[model samples]
Target: MNTVSQTLGQAPSAHVYKNDVRRKLLLIVVFFILTVLAVITDLLCGSGTLPWHVALNGVFHPDQASPMVHVVMWDLRMPVTITAVLSGIGLAIAGSLMQTVLDNPLAEPFTLGISSAAGFGAALVIVFQTSLVSFLPVDYLLTANAFIFSLVTVLFIGIFAARKGLSVEMIVMLGIAVHFIFSALLGLAQYVANVDQLQSLVFWMMGSLQKSTWTQVGINAVIIVLVVPILLLLSWQISALRGFGEQAQVLGISVARLRMLLLTFSALLASAITATIGVVGFIGLVAPHVARMLVGEDQRFAQLMTMIVGALIMTLSSIVSKMLIPGVILPIGMVTSLLGVPFFVWLVFGRSMGRR
Candidate 1:
């Protein structure tokens, strides 16, 4: 009788698990379709709006299209659209990894000073015309500097956290200190800058896609593509860590080593995007929360959904940035900040109330 009862109980749980997997998969498909639509909409709604048919024709047959249409479609709109998608994917995944590794709901690249560090690096180049790498072209000085600074900052924090076995609170505090330091440095750079340099610094910090090139897009694409699959390969372990916390060590997982590895990859993703596009904020913080709400904490599903949600949010933000001003395209970072600030407030209050 006991055996029969156990079988009955197991049967229902197995059925429920299958159903849950189906629902999560369905949500992923729906969100992916929505993301594709958002991308298409972004491609269509620039300063000189191209009709869908014309845009499609230009995309499919650039040689047959008019010279102006080809230039606008390929040279102008395509790079920005592709870069926005890549940046969103990179930032969102980085944020998800940070939150999981640190076990902190509020942790993300922007919140933890990585983005600020990148901005400061770019400011350094803009103010001094200096390049960390002598072989890099003058145009790439800002990008190389931003990448190196951001990487160094993250590695410093990661090393400290690993060696000291610091708690999540300490990690967060360290990140805050780094953020302030970089902000002060950035302000000092701005103070010393001439009018043209100040203008360039301010614009870069605001995060526009106006300067995105095919090269930048290709570099971001390769990094994201490589990093995401490695992350997914470790997804089961990540999910175990999230579910079990410190007890995950009982299952033969080296919590310290895993944390360090995840942090390094997260830094790589965040820094690369920041180097390419300046300091776009909050997509990292927001997208993972939205993904968890949709698909619980299984990193396998949550990570994929986070990327889709991030891409959708960014592409939508791009559309708004263009449409908000009649002739002027507002900075992409400003649009995301406008959307993210209210959501951030709600999250803080919601969590506090939940604790109560």
Candidate 2:
């Protein structure tokens, strides 16, 4: 009788589990469809608004399309649209990994000073006309500098965290300190810059998709493709760490090593994107939470959803940037900041109230 009772009790739970999985899967598909629509909307809504048929023809049959349509679609809009998507994916994934590894809801590349560091690095090149790598072309000097500085900042933070056995809170505080330090340095760089240098530095810091190219798109794609599989392979361990560091360590997960690895990869993703397109904020912080809300905290599903949500948000932001000024495209970073600031406020207060 007891055995029968146990079996009957377990049956409902198994069925419920299957149902939950199905629901999550369905949500993923739904979000994916939404992302596709958002991408199409982005491709359609640029300055010289092409009709769907024209846009489709330009994309699919460039040879047959008018020269103007082909140039507008291929030479201009396509790279920007693709870059936004790739940047969103990269930032969101980096944010998700940082949050999970650090066990802090607010931890992300921007908040952790990685983006600021990259900006400062880029500013160095802009102000001094200096190349960190002698072999890099003049065009790539700023990018290389940004990437290297961002990497160095994260490595410093990771090493400090590992050596000091800092708590999550301490790690966040350290990041904040790093952020302030870099901001001050960036300000100093700007203060001494000439009119042209200042204008260029300010614009880059504001983030724009205007400078994106096929080469940048390819580089961003390769980074995302490489980093994602490594994270996926360690998803189970990451999910476990999200629960409790002590527990994860007990399970032989090497929490310290895992955290260091995540930090490095997150920095890599954030740095590469920031170097390529300047500092677009909040996607990292916002997308992971949205993904978690939709799919709970299973890293596998949450990470994938985070990428989709990030891409959707970014693509939508790109559309808004174009539409807001009619003829003038507002900086993409400004749009994201406007959207993100309110959400960030709510996130902070809501968490505080929940704690109380």
Candidate 3:
């Protein structure tokens, strides 16, 4: 077995690794191009149908465009586009971190029950608007409840799991438990609601970018901008967990502590986005898996690509939401599910078939 030993022991040459990285970077560039195209299309193809040049002019030289064009491009389309990008980046990176920290390909805020908790919170406000939180304006009520409940769920899991020192398995179990409890509460809220209230709750839960505003976009952008770079700095240690696992523990990584910190960050990012945009599902999940396919499991590249893919998917979904109906905008969550579910299926069975 000397020949086999020699083959296994020889590491990949630096040149080889550099070439691989170049190829992946090229793929990332292509995806970014696609995302830019999607954003431009979104800006140009709304209900008003501003011409590409006119829309560009509206954005770049708003004073030249008519007030109507200026309003549509600057106030409406710009915020939505920015929000979609921010939400996509946040959910995608959050999903990547959750999947890595939990060691579960399927782990995301939705799967772990965090989104459900947020949804339940929003649903509660919809069903009982003014009854539970009378002081807050109706506009802020749902968002406040959703954000609070989502954080409560995370705090519950983190606090309880941290008591035992934040094992991966324990944290995951706690999240699953959080998911079920919140899901039941959501169901109960649905049952007690009147028809109009039920419709409102359902619509919100389905997700919509119709509510996007510059303020929401700015807040989300700040959070994601801060969190993503920090996660990237820890990329090598995070990547190590995939292969080295407990060996990372031996190497003084404090794998449990790292997982806890990452998990908390991921949860916070996902919750904040969900609170603003409603529950846009699966972009978090499918984006990272798609990124992993394009680039390997290297978290640095994978996470960045995940953000791009997520932004692409969400932006496309936003386009579909607008285009599917003439004047009535469809919910973005429905479009994402339609696109993401098929990709998710491909990710699962595609790998199994390839292994064969």
Best by lDDT: 1
* Two-way TM-score contest, 1 vs 3, winner: 1
After TM-score superposition, the amount by which residue 265's alpha carbon in candidate 2 deviates from its true location, in angstroms, is 1.1
Candidate order (TM-score): 1, 2, 3
State which candidate has the highest TM-score. Answer: 1
For all predicted structures, in order, the TM-scores are 0.96, 0.95, 0.91
Runs off by more than 4 Å, candidate 3: 1-12, 130-138, 165-167, 354-356
Clashes of 3: 1
Q: Provide the lDDT at 253 for model 2.
A: 90
Question: What is the descending lDDT order?
Answer: 1, 2, 3
Tens-digit lDDT string for candidate 2 (1-356): 57876777465777888899899999999999998888888887787767889998898899999999998889899999999999989989988888876787987777678878988898889997765674888888888899888888988988988899998788888989999999999999999999999999999999998899898999899999999999889888888888777578888899888989998899899999999989998999999998998998888788889999999899989999999989888989999989988988989998999931
Runs off by more than 4 Å, candidate 2: 1-11
Backbone clashes under 3 angstroms, per model: 0, 0, 1
Q: How close is candidate 1 to the true structure, as a TM-score?
A: 0.96
